[model samples]
Target: MRNRILILLATIAIYSCQDKQKTEQDNIIKTIAEDTLSKTVAGTADVSDASPTEDKAVELIRKQLNVLLKKDLPAMTKEDRFFYYEAFDLNNDKKNEYFVGFSNSYFCGSGGCSGYILNNDGTLINSFTVTDFPILVTTSSTEKFYDLIFETGGKFHLIKMKNGKYPSNPSVQEIWKGETPKDNAKVLDIDGKKLEKYSF
Candidate 1:
């Protein structure tokens, strides 16, 4: 009778451990699913062909770009100057917007780039000039907009788009860059390492 009771207690212990393991597995799976869903919802561009309205807007945008580039425009085709092109629903309006990157004529050297977010109508929403390439952040903010990340001069920087516009500042010309000139708290590396200053 004593031996039987011991065996029963061991079985209960094994069952308890198995249940705890299952619960942990479920939690991990749930977390992964949530993260993936968020990325997919924000990252999906779903663009096949431009509609008539988008076509017209694109042409007008090209023309405006030519005007901006002026003499240099003749040399740089859309494919040449435009480095990145993507369409995503950024503003949560259920309509996709354009995220474009152009080789910056203004900021040059080893690492210089420009970013733009255009409305569906091809109107200029916001523009940014960074040291390196601007990457799309695959998540929307709780404040109800998307983010763009830049790694310039080895320092990680962020630009937030609230209704397709960056904050109006001439110095940094980006949102959420850093609080003070000497502040290093905001910067991060690709490997999530903290850095001393901005570098390529």
Candidate 2:
């Protein structure tokens, strides 16, 4: 009888230890699951909070363009009647800023178009010009200190904000001249030296 009792006690001890181990394992899993759930909830909250500001910025840009279009159409030819806004990290602030460009029927020279940077409040920050109509605009880390390239006039024009203003020195070198080739897009240094060329 005593032997049976001893066996039963040993069995109980082993069972108790197994139950404790199972409970600990379950607790660890639960903790991991809760942490993952928390991260997901936080990520979703961040996106939801960010979406409204993004939407508002887009809406403001659209309104500004609409006003410009309505007011400037009378001054623009049919071919010169377009304006566009681009978003980029012009100052490397990590927040996107605006570059507004417009075609002016009034400008007669090769650089007939103008551009401006817009503040977050939709106000014009500075006025700048390009050598021609901009077919495209992009950013690169190679030229501009912040790695921004304003592709216009058959070349990439490095633009940056200096002294709380856009670079106003009109004495900068004209990187490219003549006409853009149909097959190759060329880049040049500020001294008019060729850098690289690639097919569009």
Candidate 3:
């Protein structure tokens, strides 16, 4: 009878140990699963939060700009950064123009950022030194030519196309109706002071 009692106690001890081991294994798996879930949620949130601002405009021009310029994304996005706000028909013509901004200190001097206008069909249009993007583009009534208006050093530089290029010596239109700010404007509200047809 004592031997049988000893055998029963030993069986109980082994069963208890096995049960504890099983419980431990289950807890480890649960812990791992919970940790993985939290990490996944955090990663998704990070991308979702940042994409709207930083990624939206860059993404629109990234692939196409790289292909057009014959460069990779990394090279294009270096310290000399390029960005665009919108593409619009500035001249009331059917063709749209994309206004590009350049940064990294060298591009913009006291006049704010340099602007480039590219046609939607990927043609290089006229560019001007703009306090604001596209400061103002004067288009011919028939849409045959373009005139880019920009301010530089408190002066307006009216750039017209000459031989398909904005000549190094663009006609200077000193159309400052009021005191021209020595620096670039923070927004796109460009002044049309001396830009009337009566002037040179």
Which one is best on TM-score?
1
Off by over 4 Å in 3: 1-60, 63-79, 90-93, 126-134, 139-143, 167-200
lDDT of 2 by residue, 67-152 (tens): 54566657666556444555555546677676655544553246445655677777666666554433223343333324234445
Which pairs clash in the backbone of model 1?
Answer: 153-198, 153-199, 153-200, 154-199, 154-200
lDDT of 3 at 173: 51
On residues 133-169, what C-alpha lDDT tens digit does candidate 3 reach at each position?
A: 3355544322354555565555666555666666432
Off by over 4 Å in 2: 1-55, 62-81, 103-109, 133-157, 168-200
Off by more than 4 A, model 1: 1-60, 70-84, 104-108, 138-143, 162-164, 167-200
In terms of TM-score, which candidate is stronger, 1 or 3?
1
Model 2: how far residue 60 lies from native, Å: 2.3
Q: After superposition, how far is residue 127 of candidate 2 from its true place, in Å?
A: 1.4
Model 3: ten consecutive residues of lowest lDDT: 191-200
Error of 1 at 177 (Å): 11
Q: Candidate 2, clashing residue pairs?
A: 140-147, 141-147
TM-score on alpha carbons, each prediction: 0.46, 0.40, 0.44
In model 2, the worst 10-residue window by lDDT is: 191-200
